[model samples]
Target chain A: MLTLAQAQTIMTTALAHAQSAGFKPLTIAILDARGAQKLFTAQDGTSLKRGEIAIGKAHGAVAMGIGSRALHKMALERPYFVEAATHAVGGSLVPVPGGVLIRDAAGTLLGAIGVSGDTSDNDEAAALAGITAAGLVGDTGA
Target chain B: MLTLAQAQTIMTTALAHAQSAGFKPLTIAILDARGAQKLFTAQDGTSLKRGEIAIGKAHGAVAMGIGSRALHKMALERPYFVEAATHAVGGSLVPVPGGVLIRDAAGTLLGAIGVSGDTSDNDEAAALAGITAAGLVGDTGA
Candidate 1:
């Protein structure tokens, strides 16, 4: 039951982290536990494609119940899974490092956040900061 | 142009209208001009089905460049067209009521809004109220 306000707080903080780090403009997507989109924003100047890619990353994280960083690693070690998963979601799945799950103090899965428009690692870093700033945990699979 | 604040305002007001009208819990979806989802929220007690249906309605309205009311009428008059269009979008299209386009004063397409819960007429009424409340034009097609 992550409220929309909470999602916005998390996403805004994520964008701020990107800003502070001098990262390029980023797009952020948030999805609730049901895999329903809660919020999405592509900051000014981001590429036209960033919104969908960011959303795909977040949707993938939620669908797999794991952070996208882990998926990226798995994709590297077992590329076949990536191909199959991508097709399974009708091309909405993205195996990347920018998607992360948000959890409560009790380790309940609330939702996920995905950031795009920078290096995958950097995008993950921003998402991590945002998740923490909103008083939640981000499972980066680290 | 449609700012996130404006989108939020519209969605919140739509929910309020539903609340006032004593309608069932509703879900709302807002999309930017490029058909990128900007915001989506399901009220506390809405059915799980509302989430996807709400999104589908909004996506369809944007793809067709008109309000869902018009699409609904078209579906009644030309069922085959709706079938082909739905299949075309990989089944994301919902040619039903409750989706409307937002436009600026100069008639520029800003985005679209979708609401689900209660009857289709009620949903469209709430969406239109929200559009008007936010000072945007809704292409309800009458």
Candidate 2:
């Protein structure tokens, strides 16, 4: 079962990765299975919008049970899915940087992590770090 | 002479402050004299809503020639101004957190910064950091 402690651990790890990478300040968010925020943190000098984006990305991942990057690929194959999903979510389901799926050792869905700032690759890396630090697995499939 | 470089610098600094303060992940944007984006960055994990909010705040600040916080206050006295400005900007002028005027050392208007995440106070502080880091001034009316 996913726990708040795990979420917090992921967020902390992501923040540290961002600082160490020498990227700009970052925003990290973790969402529970219900798509609610379990942990959210924005570094000093991070933009205000980072929080929203992080939440949106994580929400999308949790709601769909897939990593946002994979969703982006699916969007390309099924534009209708993308359109319908976006409309259904009231524009909160953004398939962009800073979204990752969290799973257990057995690949059971647990939650998700979203990160923003820097490049999309950098965001993915940070999210992965958070997941691993939390003793969870991250889905990076395309 | 105002330049995009200065605006970007301000935005970068503001984001850094936001992260250090433990605020939510955020999106930040800067607009030039013509109301064009000078710089835009969404920290790792920020949401799409933050982008909209940041842009709105920045637009409001530039259009009204006042900080967004002051605009929020003036909204009470001149609801019409707030309403009209909001409409004039195509519903992009949000009079809330993460927006401020950018002025030079001599108090000359250069541009504006908009931030979103956490609370309004935290947003404003981040924006102020950006302004000061850019060697510019911010009018928070505090």
- Per-model root-mean-square deviation over C-alphas: 2.6, 15.6
CA shift of A11, model 2, Å: 1.5
Docking class of 2: incorrect
Error of 1 at B14 (Å): 2.6
TM-score, B chain alone, candidates in order: 0.95, 0.90
Best by DockQ: 1
Give one digit per residue, the lDDT tens place, for model 2 in A10-80: 87788788889887777778887777778888776553344655676777788777788876676557757
DockQ versus reference, model 1: 0.34
Error of 2 at A123 (Å): 0.7
Off by over 4 Å in 1: A1-5, A19-23, B20-22
Give the per-residue lDDT of model 2 (tens digit) for B29-67. Answer: 888756788888888887758788988888887765668
Instruction: Give the C-alpha interface root-mean-square deviation per candidate.
Output: 2.9, 12.1
